[model samples]
Target: MTSLVSTSHLQLAAFALGTVGWILCTFSMGMVEWRVWHVDNTTVISSGIAWVGIWKVCFISYLHISPGYKEQFCHKFSGYDSFIPREIYVAQGLLLIAMFVGLVGLTATVFALRNVYMGIAHKTLITRFFLVGGLCYIFAGLCVLIPVSWNFYSVAQNQSISFPPSYYMPTSPAAQDAGAAIPIGIVAVILLLLSGTFSLSYRFPVATNTTVNPDGINLPSAVSEQEQSQEIRTTSRVIL
Candidate 1:
């Protein structure tokens, strides 16, 4: 007989799958945005952006809505979106703040990795690189969340408004400087790849062994008793 999955296990699995899908969708959106703005290809970029945006909205809505059923089946899931209904504006403001903070954190992580790779610090290079990459994708997700939450909160407050206008537009200078981040990201990735290559070449538990010879030792004879009456000499040497 096929084993039946419990409601809690099913909810957790759904959450895991949804999170993965959310990540992939956000990546697709980034590629679309980069091509549209950086490469100046409007047609394909526009279409890709629209498609990714629609899919992301639907996926998040499903996650938000499905918890209600899960709560009905299992009371533990009841409080997930409780604050969502009452604190819409506050939630949106917090989302924007998080997005800005994520952007700065990601940039800082990249710089930190650069320092490690340049021999400024003897730190674990791979860990720093992974941190930077993870933060990059996380910041990208925040980019998506800011607008989504803002629009949702607006709609919840006022149904008459179709959708909130974009709240996270890049300034002209920022848009111009966008190309610079790619080079930084590329350098971090290259450093990470080199660290991996080095790791693969090394064997574990390197050993060091040493030996000493007792035959080289000398002992003074009993004549030293009589010689003790004579003058003793001492010498010191210094090497520079």
Candidate 2:
């Protein structure tokens, strides 16, 4: 007989994890605040504290004289920071695209699970559809990964030493670290990959009974022709 319980749990788990990753990635993409790290300025009056994101940047002042948030302002990319790291832009676009693609994948997976009992043909169709959706998840993860990775590297290099000269860096003494979004994106990638692998690993259950149908054929006959011939010869010898 056929059973869905065995693999259903695993598939559902993978789907749930992938969905969580998707939500995190979406949040990260839209979030334009809280960068990996900011310049560690000693003086309270000094304005080095900043929160940066892929789409926008901001400067926060926490001067000692006016502690408790006297004034804080957020600003968008003004197209003034050197040549503007193109990687961020690319990442932004990719993440957005991934979100949409992942949506389609999730939809396919849900429907595929539902149609599992529609016979071998339907099951095969579901398997293929799920695989395609998994591919989309993977692609979307990659899209999120590229930009996050590039940004992390760029920030590290800039913070480590003056490679592109002083002007290229974000002000001076600005330390860098991995942002929250980076990890979120990484998690999403892992989940997406797992979801895809699950889809590919799905195996159609086999039955010992033979069935003859145009669209269906139970593989591996119960007894091969050679085995049948040998059995017949043994029977004749026993009768004699």
Candidate 3:
């Protein structure tokens, strides 16, 4: 029992560290995409991306350090299998795809905004979509991690027998509890995909064209002709 408690404490520490690292990675990546690229600052973007990558490396390393033992140290403790179900792996793969898509969307939006300079509205829309998609990925990740944490707590508490004695047996209380999390993760992935689609759509004009002139000025045609004429007259008077 003492050994179990020690192991549980170690596992909990690892889970906490991994979660914090992942959160830092997510935040840094967002800063790279939003505050840096969206704001037309490449240096900050590069720095932020690098920082995120470092955090990701640390997160993965922590996962490796505590492999097969992460789910036995937190609330909702399920069992060992809950930490590494096939569905969880699939969800992780989907999250990677979503992350890639979001990064691509960010890059495209940044490039478009930088070159066009007048598509601020479009850029804003795309940025929002990317943000939503990224959040979906983050949420999905949480869903996966939660069950794993639960399983760790259960194992640490020596509650592995809460599951059926045999893996092939009918649904055990443990199995039922662990199974509940998979659907939530799937839902999150679906929402993320939908957000990614919306992000792509935002790249185009949804309404009337608000284009910029050669002088790099965005002109809304909704302005009255009289207003335009007055503006022209005012400019002429100023020049004279």
Candidate 4:
């Protein structure tokens, strides 16, 4: 006779936290206008003149779309009209893969919940499911982190070593800075790490020794009459 399983507070909390981190990480992926330039060079003084993202980069509307303030306007980049950079392409692929793995992790987490299954066999299965989910999240975190960190490092004036001649990073005034998405990705990675760690360490199936009756009497209070009589006699003998 199977019954509804109860989920512990710890299990629910970890799942919620992990899901939140995944959402934030995905949101950060779409935020563009990264690596904008703020130059005080004698030749130019442009502010927020470009838009860069993991997937694409474009110059802000320089013509009369929503003119006056270029910083307030954005233009769409296309494969036919604009040349896309290689690093951005790499970033896009890795970030997409990260999101895909995170989706798998979320799916596994659903089955890992205590209320989802209630047998000894299921107990072990759920634990393994959660363990796999946690590892996937860790992988997802690394995937996003790699691109974000690499992009930042590539542009950092003090830290940049020369890029290979074939895969050379272009010297753009815009490359001198980071973007809004950078901090957001950083926070997401931290949350994912914490959430996965907590999920991995959680102890479910707190009780290991569960006694079930062989005669279809599953209730703990329902024992054999002979056993009850023996228990009573043993109590009387102790009293005497």
Evaluate model 1: give its TM-score: 0.24
- Looking at model 2, report the run of 10 residues with the lowest lDDT sum: 160-169
lDDT of 2 by residue, 1-240 (tens): 557545556666657866887887788887764254456653432465555677765455554233354555444554455445677668768888989988887887777777764333455676777787678777777877788788778767754322133222244445666777777777888888787777666775655566463558654566677886898899999999
lDDT value for model 4: 0.64
By TM-score, the better pick of 1 and 4 is 4
TM-score to native of every candidate shown: 0.24, 0.72, 0.27, 0.65
Across 17-87, the per-residue lDDT of candidate 1 in tens digits comes to 33343333333333312111222322322212111121111111111223454211111112333322333
Error of 1 at 148 (Å): 1.7
Which of 2 and 4 is ahead in TM-score? 2
Candidate with better lDDT, 2 vs 4: 2
Least well predicted 10-residue stretch by lDDT in candidate 4: 160-169
Q: Which residue pairs in model 1 clash with each other? A: none
The TM-score-based order of candidates, best leading, equals 2, 4, 3, 1
**Model 3 whole-model lDDT (C-alpha atoms):** 0.35
Give each model's clash number.
0, 0, 10, 0
